[model samples]
Target chain A: MDKRLALILSEVFRLKEKEINIALTKADVGSWDSLKQMDLVLTLEREYNILLTIPDILRMVSVAGIVDVLREKGVALED
Target chain B: MVALVTGGGKGLGLVIAEHLLSNGATVVVVDRDRDALDALPTSVFGKCLDVTQPEEARTVVASVVKEHGRIDVLVNNAGVIYNEPLVNIMKPEGIMHDYGRFREAVTVNLDSVFIMTCAVVEQMVLLRTKGVIVNISSISACGNEGQTAYAAAKAGVNAMTVTWSKELGRCGIRCNAVAPGFIGTESTHQALSVDSIKHILQNTPLGRLGKAQEVAQAVATVIENEFINGVILDVNGGLVI
Candidate 1:
């Protein structure tokens, strides 16, 4: 879960792997705007081939929440 | 009063050339179609030149300047359109889709604008001539389906307008763009019926198609309004919300 969350965060926010922290939230990253959130959702859908609902997207307000949604969608998260 | 308009042989370019010529500005109509160039009125100095070629642009601008002694306005109006879903786009399947057509569209639509503008601007700056450059952009620039390359290219034009407005502002050259929505041109009317037009109109606030002259009027306003620079005027009747 930590590794997958870090990878997604790094790719979506264009940050280095070392720069991403599991505790990061919307307020923690300046790049986490509404547009970037939409882009993140789209990227996750395309990369994992999982159709996310509006509720799922809205619930993913933090890195841990994104991992929770991915787990709910049956995506295997590497610890 | 010399002015150069690429693709001035037909469509919006033809209307803009006529408007400028009617205002007593000597016009040079550049197009790849010699027949179309010949079809222009005698008042216009027509030349068959493919603007994609940088050398050709320089040569034509020089010829127009030699004959008219000055270039007061330049309108980069030549463009092409394509419709294909981004994912299903064949024939140059790659990162950007339709790589061949994408390359050609970028060259003709975006690069040619840069080539012509640079060529004309060099002369304008050397002669210390204050002039106007109006790039014809599309509402698709905002983001539309089946227009990945076209959108990127037109967006490039919009960005260039802003950058050039600052770079050449000191030289008294104003750069601006016009983003037109779906207008009821001959081609558009043929492609779309009254019912389809109504759909677009329903989406648009004005509830009708736009005339080419309306777009020309917007361009003319940009040209006449000296203070107006780095502006991407929406002549779409508020279609783009």
Candidate 2:
């Protein structure tokens, strides 16, 4: 889950692998905005091949929240 | 003088058509919306056109030249937009649920611009007329959320603006673009929330939503100013940094 979340964050925000710390938020990242937020949601859904509702997108505000939503959707982490 | 304005039936296009008519230029409003065309003033020439179809574009241009004798100004103002996030767009859901809207937006906004511009340029060259083309770009060209396809397309428009300027400059023709910010159109006003409006105002030094007339005025200025070529005139009230 951690690795997949990192990959999604890095690609959507165009951040380096090291820049995608778990503590990342809209304030910590300059590129983070409503538009990028939407893009991030889309990228996650595409990457995981899962459907995210508008409610899910609106509720996801942090890295942990994103992981929790993915877990709720039953996306298993690779061991 | 014959002037062709793609998507001239409403909003910015309508304003441009009215402005050109006031300037004594015969205006041709080309759009796919027949009902919208019917609503336009009778003095303006309204043609039902699907500009993405290159052959139709050629036919429309030829018909205009045959009727009007010469071409002078071509304004590519017809465009569409999709506000959904890209992920929801790529899902394998039904057409309406997925990125189908994005495909249409790209076709109408981006592809049509290329087809129409090329068609007009060919006519201008064959007629040996020194012409002007005003491409209606957007603030999104600099990048915006929920507008990946649109931003890419407008960016392409800006690039083509510069490239066409160079290609057509030696032919005594000019090509430029008008990148508009938020305007006070009914649709825009409806789509944006009060906070979104406030945010836009705060970012814009002018502290106001731009008017369609203001954008039309800029387009007119670009058309008249032969010295301004391959330049994108930003009418976004300084919204873009």
Candidate 3:
């Protein structure tokens, strides 16, 4: 996982860096509510300097899904 | 802070804009009247656009963002106080209130707020700008007599203010409305007859009409207070009606 992506998720959801994993989904995080989702989307947009569509935003329900969406948007998300 | 005020070319809106400017905000005033827009102070950035049109609102909002980087606050003060009885018993013909005028009042009072808020909020969300929206409502929202359309529109404005505050709070956006009572403004005096003004004064606890600056102060208070959200604050002088 990209260090920046992991750090953003950790900061946005107020979780430990080690807690961020590809297997983690929004349902697993108690703090991943609508507000947190907006924060995540904003943080990701700022970090990647990319605009996300509604579909892309909705598809980012899990870490793996977020990775896939970023990849589809031409974001390498490499370490 | 960059503040955009609609219908800010004259009356109470101008007062609010100037007050915001005095408070160190870069103020942008938009009005439909070119003459009024031109009459604004040089320090204010005046743009002539009808706020009721969604397309025009979007275009103006985009231009404002382009010029000022982002809008930190939006004051939806572009509205007309349309006074018409539901039915005029003395009229010989067409006694009922004109439907066309009612629609126009709604369009100007309620639709402008919705349209401008949509455009500004879209920009704020996309830019991730933490912003405040201050909608200028009126005491008439509580169902003022002889102002069916105006009252209905202001009530709608109050509803939108609450709804947007709940929806946008997560986005770090606050929505609030300042409902002013009868103020000693040119428009207010022009709208109400001498007897009507006397009646209002007698009923008001303060025994006088409100000043525009007081309403401006209320607006500034809501804008400055970070914790305030979805509040339909009344700037009236203890006048319920």
Candidate 4:
């Protein structure tokens, strides 16, 4: 699940796989603007088959942040 | 199966309603024009409705479900167009259109679709029927001359098609859109001059305008195909890339 989420984030933000740092928030990534944030939210929701609330979507700012949300939704992730 | 078509009074909407009915699905048609609704065949279930009226959408949706067990298909095909560019063509001193025209374009084309879809989808969820929605877009969705408002609304339909498919897929409902080019409908025949029509044909790869039946075939195909989801199927005859 982590691998899939990372890939989707990388693709949406147009970042190289190696450049997709867990600490890189939307403020850090040049491409992760508000519009791309919405795209990421939609993509993540579709990819994981989870419905995200507006608050959850707004809080999604980085890879670690996404992993936390997915985990809350009971999405099993690789250790 | 049961289906509902907006703007089924005339032009392409009428053809789509007939096509679905002929394919063994019962149909309910709604239109703002009383005259157009009256002209339909006696067998068709017709309603003279102005969808823009706030309460009409919910009332019509409820009535259709009450009469029919369920609506398995919905075609959001109601729309209007004004071929006025950003700059005034009719009067050089004024702008292309007043604020009212712009509001009317978005209201009729975009708002009506959103309202009707929500109303139908709510019932579909309650009944737990796997429903299908097909939105009729236009080639102008990409961009077209004198279609500032129409293009925006059609493009909004395309976006909703994709968004709804994702959001509603869990409920077993699927959504798609069809963007058509110039079609030889009664409205098109009356709107464009012979010389302008000739120019359009010359530019079209098929060397002729599309028939309404041809578009009906595409809409029916989408409804029949279970695998196609979140697709903006272009029925244009290669007019644009």
Candidate 5:
């Protein structure tokens, strides 16, 4: 897992790095409810200094999905 | 620039639309009055919309985004004013007031402002476009006799203007409001008679009613000045001061 991505995931969902996976989704994670989804959005925005619209939010459903969108935004997840 | 002015079909709204158009923005004006929409020039796009409906608010924002690609500014100028003393508003027998009128006043003035601003700002955030929102509030926001609904709603507008500015400013968006005092418009004419206008002017320090153009200029100033945020610029000829 990319270190920054793991950091955000852990901070947003209060999870350990070992528990997270690319396939992990809001449905799979008990803490990833709607409110959590919004919180994650704000957290991602604050961390990345990027803005996501409703459509962008709808597309980012899972950890892998978030990684993909972050890549599209040119965020350096590896560091 | 792309701008949307609610209640653009008539009165001050119309003037605001014209000002934006003249300033080189692709202006979209929405109003519930079909006749008012028809009155707009061919150069401007006019939509007959009742913004109080959440669905309509969504659709308008979506279409504006699709067609214009971005909304640079939003002027929430769609509103109405009605005045009837509380005593006359107890229902069933009051000659001066009706509950329906109060509901309509708030719905049009305040509720629509809330719905439309949220819809527009959502898209603005998504686009990552720095935008400006100017809400049309009123001096009655401070409070006025027989204007409970109008006062509450306009005051709500001012409050939201400040709140959104703080919340969204980090996203490169700014929210501000314009509170006009006795602007000359068809709506004003409907709300007050000549004698009432005269009395208001007499009490006003400036000794005159404000013009819609003055209000439009204040709105434009807030929109242009990037550093200004969360301000309720009054265009009332220093009435309250």
Candidate 6:
């Protein structure tokens, strides 16, 4: 699950998988603007087969935040 | 490319669909008229549905995506040409335009475009398809006198086209409108009086009605050109100029 999440982030942000980490935040990524944020939200929703709320989307500014939001949405992130 | 054209069963929409098919596109046509859908060519896919309803729009879009895998282009062409002056002094009573009729026109013309676009755009984004949207606006969008509802609806369509072009460009989606002038379609003839058409011809530099094929070609051009976004291409033969 971790690897998949990293892959999605890398693909959406155009970053290397090695560059993605739990510490990575929107500020740390150069391409994590509003547009890419929408892409990320869509990608995660499609990948997890879950609909995200506005608060869930806003809370997902960092990798750890994304994981927390997923968990809150009943997405089991533990490998 | 897989193209979905609403109101493609007859008239200008049918011509547009055929033009796309000739250009090697897989065209799916949806219209509210069942008889018209039944008359479409065997090569084109036809579905009967009212584009104004959100659920029906979503369902048709889903079915098309399920069959063709993705929708590359969506042409919003389903609309009614409503002509009524805001005030008709000739009438004995109710000189003002009927609010119900105005609402009906706006619903069919503008709301249908909104509903269909949302449905197709969702599929395009989810499938990651770089898609194009071509809205069939009218020359009346600039505010013709006897067409309050039609003009307002088409102007709204133009605004939405530009707005979506900016919003969806990052997602590899392009939106544009083709505002055709007095096209020599049956509907155009039915909509205008003989004197009105003559006046239009006198004002237009081309001095003739536009062909349906010409509008279709404009649609094709916008779809094929990768950089033409948020443009309202006028196919009016310099009528408004």
Q: Is the docking of candidate 4 incorrect, acceptable, medium or high quality?
A: incorrect
Please give, for residues B138-190, the per-residue lDDT of candidate 2 as tens digits.
89898876677788789989999999999999999999999999998876766
On residues B1-241, what C-alpha lDDT tens digit does candidate 6 reach at each position? Answer: 9999999999999999999999999999999999999999999999988998999889989999999999999999999999887865334356578999999999999999999999999999999999999999999999987789999999999999999999999999999999999999999999876656877999999999999999999999999999999999999999983
TM-score list, all predictions = 0.72, 0.75, 0.75, 0.73, 0.72, 0.75
> Residue B239, candidate 1: how far off, in angstroms?
0.4
lDDT of 1 at B115: 94
- Give the per-residue lDDT digits (tens) of candidate 3, residues A1-79: 7888899899998789999999999888866654567678889899888888777777888999999998888898874
lDDT of each: 0.82, 0.84, 0.92, 0.83, 0.85, 0.92
Residue A50 deviation, candidate 6, in Å? Answer: 72
In candidate 6, chain A reaches a TM of 0.93
- Candidate 4, residue B41: the lDDT equals 84
Candidate 5 runs further than 4 Å off: A1-79, B89-92, B95-97
Evaluated against the true chain A, what TM-score does chain A of model 3 have? Answer: 0.94
Backbone N/Cα/C clashes per model: 1, 1, 0, 0, 0, 0
Between prediction 2 and prediction 5, the one with superior lDDT is 5
- Residues B93-123 of candidate 1 have per-residue lDDT tens digits of 2423557877887888899999999989989
Candidate 6 at residue B241, lDDT? 31
User: Clashing residue pairs, candidate 5?
Assistant: none
Q: What's the residue-level lDDT of B127 in candidate 2?
A: 89
DockQ for all candidate structures vs. native:
0.02, 0.09, 0.01, 0.01, 0.01, 0.01
Model 3: which docking level applies? incorrect
- Give the winner by TM-score: 1 or 6: 6
